[model samples]
Target chain A: MKRILATLLACVLLLSCMSFAAAEDKKTLTVWIPQYQFSKAEDAISDQDFWDGVFDPFEVENNCEVKVEIVGWGIYGDTFFTSLVNEDGPDLVYVTDNYDLVKRDLLLGLDPYLTQEQKDNVILWNTAPENANGEKVIVPMDDGVAIGYVNKALLKEAGLDELPVEWDAFIEACKTIQEKTGKRAFLQNWGATSGTSALMLAFWPYYFQAGGKMLNDQGEIDINNEAGLKTVEFLKSLLDAGIFTEDIVTESESVDKFAAGEVAYIVADLNKGNSAFTPAGIDWEYVFSLKGPAGYGARTATDSFAVNKKTVARGNDELAVKALMYITSGAVMDEFHSKIFYLPPFTKDASFVKDEALYALTSAHSEDVYVVEEFSAKKSFEDTLLANIQEMFQGNLEPQEVLTETMDYYNTQLKEN
Target chain B: MQKTFFSRRRRQALIGGAYILPSFVLMFIFNVSPIFLSIFYSFTKYDMTAAPVWVGLDNYIKLSQNKYLGNVLTNTVQYVLITVPIQTILSLLIAAFIAGSLKNRYGSFLRSVIFIPVIASLIASAAVWDTMYKPDGGLINQFINLFGAPSVNFLGKKPTALPSVAAVSIWKSTGYYMVIYYAGIMNVSTEVQEAAIVDGASPIQRFWYITLPILKPITYMIVTLGIIGSFQVFDLVYKMTGGGPGRATLTVAYMIYSYAFQDKRMGYACALAVGLLVVILLIHLIQTLFFKERDAK
Candidate 1:
């Protein structure tokens, strides 16, 4: 009986050790999501709760662990690269992947890891991620069109019942708002806080609406054409008139006053504005479709998911691809649509959008969505242009001089490249 | 016995070297090596991701073509000149005042209070000052409004933005330099002060002719460090104006950072950094020479 008991105990110990080893072999996946993902005040679902609810089944099914870290947006870009270089980079990084990151060879191409079914789920965008070698490495997960937001109560107080559809009338309404309320009229960001946000959110749409594009077929800047000049002059006039508040100079300073009912309107999408103002109980509405001489053009940004090269280098590419696939899956995207008010999900079956107001803004300005090549050259080009634009706004340089300097600077860059 | 004596001295020297070996190793690893490595990086296009590509003198040559280079340098030099003197003199004055009474409870309390800003984080101070400097609903503007004056856009207008940003730097640094000056003032030979007093010298006369001359070495250190700090000013400017309202406050340090990190022109940024280092080193050498000549006199 003693001999039998000893043999049984040894067998049990071997089984337990094997089980522990199997558990240890399970791969861990890390996803870097911005802290802002939880979105203003937890009035909506917290990012952790939403992801936990969405990902629990996946983790259980695969017997793998998922670690989600909420990185702040300001430091997100730096973290994205540094973490990769250090070899502990997340399996997946959630960012608005600037074409620059693609050019830098920091991300792995998804083509190899993605299955036919997964590729079928990909959304068609005006521009897809193409790395330096023109390989599609990242895919768009969500899209948002930049429209206008208005504090309706303030507008009503200014004796304007309708939002202005034309730029001239917009200026007139701004003057009226200032005259009545003794508050700044519109709050347009004139500074390059995010280097290109003011351009993307405010000025780029105007330039597009006026029938201007940054580049032509040969990849040369047709930037300072007639429409571009008109766009600049229009902004210059608005600046000279002092429609935007002095607070526009700082990057982090938002149009909080607009939401607080101190300013009339701001050039931000309804979804973007609502995330902040809704928590504060600010009654805001989307008022957009900025019509110019040519037509309406919208500011569109893609929130994308890119797999890290390090993940593939470590032979975890399949797992990383699966994680991205799970994120952009119909069910997860559908939930995100409702919670975050992102544009209709990319997956065809997950075309879920929550807010009727978002649909209204999207339908109103979605067709006019503008695209730009934000690759390696874009940062330097936009930086030079925006600095000169700031100079023009401050009365240090004329709009003509601003146009000349900006054109010359980027053209030189083009030649050099 | 002579051989034994030499052997004992050699052993003592080895023991001393062993005691300091770790510190010497650490100093080289942390400080000396990075300086040399950075010099090498200055000549190569390194984006931290890929292997560095050697570009000879191309990066340095690009500096001559930078259109805003002169303007940025002007902003940097103006900042250093304006902030260093004011910071140094003000700190010395405060140090002189607080040094005499450091023994009492109130005096110690004052020292702690003055040093609080020095101890606080630069980024945090910049953020707090951002709120304080706002034109609307800001502390400074609120106070200015009490006088029934029009609100000033301290950070918005070109004329005031640089000075406004500089004021924040000065406020953040004054306490730090004050502590340094106070330490030096504490070390002032009491015998000299007593002799001056005995010779019927007034307080002002003693401070000017006796105490001032004696504190020259500490003053040199404070000024040199202050100049370097002013040149390297970035956090406040980055958080506050971001070199704007139209490049009103774009310092050389901030530009270097932007080029390196934001633009990813690593070699060009390193070249700019090397240029800045050279300029500061030249100033340091000249200042050291002048101080040595004065001391020799």
Candidate 2:
């Protein structure tokens, strides 16, 4: 019995040592991707399956292990902050606005790793090498415009030949539709829990359309001036005209109503527009941002792949950058865009968008669509601004008060940041 | 003999210490260390990514100038006032009635039923309540419409949002407190109740005079726990309102979460957290003094 026990213990120790040796043979690269609408293919069985299909070949080629986690939007901030604070963050992540991360030096610069062709071919947005304090910290992944969706059936019922391209004409069309069809017109979602949906759809596009600059030369928020007040007053006019109501500030039921043809127009981004309207089988057309007093403007969304500096700490910086580049390559992104919804890919030649009309309209207005300045105070400013606008819609605050209060909060928070 | 006795006592003490050493070490690492670190971090500007810069009193000064601080504090106090008293009284009454009149199988089944919400997930409960409070075709709105009344956006209006969230918290918590009170009441002496009955005391009188006094310690404990719990409310408000409709339901805890996580203002959030700790400590001290005074009287 003693001999048998000794033999068994020896065998167990040997197996444990072998397992540890095997683990040490290959390095593990951790990646966290926030849950986007098109992060996975529609027909894929699960996120794990989709990511496995994308990463298996790369892992084999690199002779390393790739571990991926799909994080939800709601807890993404908390998860990333806590993990990075403990020095246990993933090697790479998808970041839309990297200002906060860059300010803290949490991201690894990708400029040293990028090939000249990658740099020249990819259309970088705000995080270009020249713009990011001379450190290229992100590789552009997808681009989208803040545009409105018009239900063609509803427009036909309302006796409009085409969706209005100008703000005044759009307002007139909405009012005429409300009067004739007795259906609500022009709904913007204010209650989206994440991503400052209201500010993107209802506020910033209009503010820019009215010729407002988000920041001044001194890097101060400059939205409390005439253009800001005008945007607020325009929204207030909508409230007074019964185009918006207290219900609009509640959780979003706008897309559902629009698909049901109870509403004629609703503002949405590319992914949300296609995924929502196409599946509902609604005859909807994209309306490039309505031209306003300053000509025309829309909010553009650009997200990128960011490598964490923790990759360098782990001695896998090159491996992580290689993986990021592979993921953002033209072929991979084209497949990704075609499988889900259409967003303009980073590479000029990568065009797999199924919706050509949307592609053309978005491209035509691409120069007019602008993303807000990258700053640490963006989230706080957007949240408070949304709340203040909601108050204005409730008739609790005047337009000037909304602008003043929002800017006050933003400037104060910006100082802390 | 004296030396032997002392040695035996020392041995016993050593054994006890050995038994408690593991838990003490764990507590020190996880709980005690974090408390001290939080206090230290409150005095510095630390974003967790870089070395903390000593910025004495800056975070605190910013707190004083924060325009939203007063509103969040008022909301938190209002939430505590609304939830704690109502839940305490309701749980106490229900527990007492069950013990006195319906101490049968039906009572046991009813207790189990009432305890259901205590076991349900807060997120799930809040989500259900949010849907039910929706303005368009929600359960409550649909029922109200039966009487030919217009739909009311219960959570969209500032006046109704906080109270609506409070209602959900009360619903979720009353059961847990009810169970505690039920156990406390079960431990009450039957002989005392019989003695009061022999003196020709009525049900109400016996309850007021005997059972209530016996449950005083339990009541104090329940109220203290309730106050702390209510003051630190986050999940219900987070799921229900997200501090929306123009900051109507913003609480201090949610604000701290937003700052620490969303805004990455760790030092400011730590200052806020330390302030919350002091407030809770003062509240507990006051509650203890009140209970002691009542006992002395």
Candidate 3:
């Protein structure tokens, strides 16, 4: 009877030890993901599907758990800002151009956490995130790139055989479309309620392709530079000729006008140019680069992801890091891009050309992409600059007035800060 | 005996305090504290993430310097002036008809139909109105085209955008004020109304002399709330025109939102908010003083 009691005690101790070991091995990672609903699509192709189809295997194989909370972009600003400041955020956060997290020191820099193998697997776009102090706090997850779209019918009506590649010919085509067809020649989205739209689609490409810089090394307004003057002069000429319309007050109208074939040339991203316009049966062509005075190039915004230090403090940092690496690795990224038209940067390991016919729809002419860099005091500058531009379009102010007033406003805001 | 009376009084006071504790706590947390915080934040440059920096009166100075302030103030006041009195008079007339003239079941059904817009989501209502006011393939345009009128982009053009948005506001709010007036008319002394009727008062005279005076308080409420709502109009403008066509529909409230969230200038937003509050209070004070003098006379 004594021997039997000893054997029972030993079995209980062994079982208890195994339970502790199992608890130490497994972990749970939480991610906040944004969702989009494509037009005419019944069920939303949500981010949860990403976890289920892509990350579920990663979770199972690693013997860990991943929780994906599908949030919408409608309330994303308030919700994300609240969670981040409170430091009660998720393990991984999905954000597009989130410089505040870096400026406020709320996020953990990913440079130290990434492995050599992990670094090689993903395209590290958005390398020069301003005010990050050279630390990559957020790694880009998807392309928010914008390229110009050509309406074939509108172009044909204007008697143009091919899409214009130079700035001069582009304006000429705009003039022809207006003179011949009596339709609006070109649509540059101005007076946009969304400040980002005004800058990204209308002004950024023009500024960049003209060799204009946002700021000098000393962080002063570089408004009087030759590049800026050249670009502003060009835009003013277009406005003076009535090539650009002041009818658009919102971004959605730009898309609607394009879909209705009301404009000859428009600048839009793939989702806007293809998903909305193509499905509506509008004959369209996509262009990446337009040669201007300085050079040939294009720059568009990028959507990205970042890790929270609160998750690191919770000791689930390793799991979150693994999740980011696994999802962005060349193996999964190709599959991810194949489903959506949001193609990643060129990687030799992945095959994005699923169909030869659809290849033109997914590729950009230039790999040179520019993400909007956000700094602490850039908001006031953006507001002042965009307001002047809008006024100029509405015939309230001229390009020279816009230029002078913008510099004055920039200086005033700088002095106050 | 005196000591026992005092003890009983203390116990009564304690019980009363216990009864009102929940509401007091809620008001303190939600309403009272926010007002104080808003006032404090107006003087500080408080970006949402960083620690606030003290910058006294700088925000207010900038607000004064803003070139668009005049337009925003004009738009807000114009909206209020257009919407409030029209809504008040219309709702009162409708409520009177429903209360006195309309048959039993029909009045209820009519009230229900009118109140439908009140209960419908504002965003959804804006969307439906947007489609109706659209330039092409719109109901309003389609109707106007019958008389050979050219297509008008009601929400798109600057001249028509503000008025178009205002019309939607009036349509949405008239029924809500009507219900309020309906309740006020019901509570009015029936005996007074009957005496006026027996004293050879016509139906119009009875309503004008008898019901209108009794509805003064309700009218004040409807008008004041209407003024406030119009002054702070954001959702319709946001959904319909987005304060666009060159700031035609930009209101003070929309400007505040732009400053606070989009521009990340929280101090300036709070300053604007405080300015709005002060203006509202002054208007109410004038209204009260004017009404008090009239009553005394």
Per-model C-alpha RMSD: 3.5, 2.7, 4.9
Write one digit per residue (lDDT tens) for candidate 2, span B88-206. Answer: 99999989888877899999998888889999999999999999999988999999999999999998998988889998888888888888889988988889878888899999998
lDDT-best of 1 and 2 = 2
- TM-score, cand. 1 vs. native: 0.92
Off by over 4 Å in 1: A1-20, A38-45, A48-53, A131-134, A220-222, A245-254, A276-283, A340-343, A411-416, B1-3
Error of 3 at A329 (Å): 1.6
For each candidate, report its DockQ versus the true two-chain complex: 0.44, 0.61, 0.33
For candidate 2, the TM-score is: 0.94
- lDDT of model 2 at position A344: 80
In the range B19-102, model 3's lDDT, one tens digit per residue, is 999999999999899878888999999878777888999889988887778988998888888888888888898999999978
Candidate number of the best TM-score: 2
Question: By lDDT, who's the top model here?
Answer: 2
Arrange candidates by DockQ, descending. Answer: 2, 1, 3
Worst 10-residue lDDT window for candidate 1 chain B reads B258-267
The TM-score that candidate 3 achieves is: 0.88
User: After best superposition, candidate 2 residue A212: deviation in angstroms?
Assistant: 1.9
